[model samples]
Target: MTAKFHAFLQNGTWELVPYDASMNVVGSKWVFKIKRHLDGSIDRYKARLVSQGFTQVPGVDFTKTFSPVVKPATVCTILALVVSCGWDIWQLDVHNTFLNGFIAETIFVHQPKGFEDNNYLHHCKPSLFIYSREKITIYVHVYVDDILITGSSSAHVSHLISNLSQTFDLKDLGPLHYFLGIEFHRDAFELILSQRKYILDHLLKINLAAAKPVSSSMATSFQLSRFTREPLSDSTQYRSIVGALQYVTLARPDVAFAVNKVCQFLQSPTDEHWGAVKRNLRYLKGTIDSGLIFSAHSSDTLIAYFDADWASFPNDRRSTGGYGIFLGSHLTLWRAKKQPTIAWSSIEDEFRALANTTTELL
Candidate 1:
């Protein structure tokens, strides 16, 4: 706690002021975490002091507090592009990035525990800074503090690291071995991306690691209905498994359609739904060894395919549409979703699915 307070003070995070009752005081808390590498080695212990933003009034305290995140598809596309050329990947962490934002509202947060402070509130700017030169473009994607640096040239990457090091308190973690829970393993030719640890942890979470394996994500003879007489005692458990399964679809595109089917029942799931979830888990059990491998030999060609099952939803008569985008020979992106508008015929549903795929492709 002393170290955290000292660091905050060193970063000029906030100034200590006299207690003022007129200003609303927001609460602050210290968050402690242990950082680890992709190989399960301890990197460092982290301490962060954050304000209880829930205590702040929306318009008065801050007009907006929003941050953009890198989309999973964008990550996949970038990875495919990088691996297609077998280029190097790197990661950088900006220390105290949350404090980098420009605050517009006057909000006060109570001093952190074991620290002397009066109040707190701050807004942030883009915080994501980028620079590029002719034939040397370096891009940084900042989802809050975690930054990913990648580009075409090795020299450009190194230069960007030097520039970033001079500007902010940054850690140059060499090579992007891991980012956003996805692990990268590179060889002479291709980069293999996997969520093995995530899958094992997920299996352990629901106590299904030792369960019997199945070849298919969904039961061949089973059909799910909206009606449920015997709902699971804990609906959260169903939601939890379904949510985790969604992430599993990241590397295993084979399960995308199956997982999307389960996601639609998040609000009210029953034992029947849980049974289907278990079936999906069992499918994962059999296919835990599979992950996305982008080979350098494959051409960086884009191909998208779309199809639909006209008026398939038993509850709403809405058609189910599916699309897959392939980067080279690798399936980089895919989705299985219910259509928003009810289609009158299969031709209309096909056209709708085509339009959706076109939007994604464009």
Candidate 2:
């Protein structure tokens, strides 16, 4: 993986230069994994070179880092339009896509292991830019190395892919089946999105395969308090559970509030919190097949809903604000967070939540 990234850098894909005095360089690390076949056979050993984006300081390293993404509703709307118009929808992937993005901040990456250029000995520079070539629409969705590219015409898609292939070795996966862990299936009538495989894998990983599933994500009367019976000995285990549940909520919004509530206790979890976390896993066992599905729909309108619970947190008297945004029938974004300030009334709390949601929407 390091070698591949080094080659990408060498070919004017992206570059490593001196870190800017004003910008903080986010860390990078190599992720190693093994690929497997559908039948559980080993495919090959793989490695991912990723940026430790968590360290990025919001305004210094990146201003306006939030990139607008196609909502699930938008995706569904497009699918529905395709179905109604009888237009062919094809998926194209651009391999090593982040390499194409020009970094505005001066940044440097340690020469990849085993493939370092000894001659350079010091610094390297990037050569690619948005205007380097014009055959392709540069709009690309990047989540690490995996990318999904779409264009208005097949010819445009083909031209873009051809141009990208010239820069780096490109793999044509043909049509969008799976990207970003979401499974997609399209036919003449409709398109379906689900995370069945991911959910099953998650359940098994958390040892909840045989656990009895719950009907809903949380109990109706369930409430969490920072004060609990006994402190957990290992906070790491609690955090691991929180991390797993966070991923599961990607397809399961029913558990978003519960999961976000429990995540706050990662720093000092208790037995009560642990029990609730386990219950969430049990809930997952039953809803392993549940996922956001975008069908053929007519709505292209975007709407948002916001709410807040005043003084919900007993420890700090902080309110919890929740919001969900929808493009049409599909839920695109949802957040549950503890407000920073204490609210005197429910109305004030709701106002704050609305402000936050509006900021996010804009």
TM-score of each: 0.87, 0.76
Error of 1 at 322 (Å): 2.4
Least well predicted 10-residue stretch by lDDT in candidate 1: 118-127
Any runs in candidate 2 off by more than 4 Å, and if so which? 1-6, 9-30, 36-43, 49-110, 116-139
- Over 1-362, each residue of candidate 2 has an lDDT whose tens digit, in order, gives 75557556666654556545554545557778876543347856776666777776677767765443444334544444444444544444444445344558755555555655677645433211122245533334434454455544567657777887886566677777766566776775556666666666666776777888787767767778878689998888789768877876666677889898888888888999988988887777776666665545546567899998899788899999999877666566788889988998888998999999998666
Q: What 10-residue stretch in candidate 2 is worst by lDDT?
A: 123-132
Backbone clashes under 3 angstroms, per model: 5, 0
Candidate number achieving the greatest lDDT relative to the actual structure: 1
Q: lDDT for each of the candidates?
A: 0.78, 0.67
Off by over 4 Å in 1: 16-24, 39-41, 57-65, 118-130
Residue 32, model 1: lDDT of 88
For every candidate in turn, the CA RMSD to the true structure comes to 3.4, 5.5
Q: Can you give the lDDT of residue 48 in candidate 1?
A: 83
Residue-wise lDDT of candidate 1 within 13-32, one digit each (tens)? 76655556577788888898
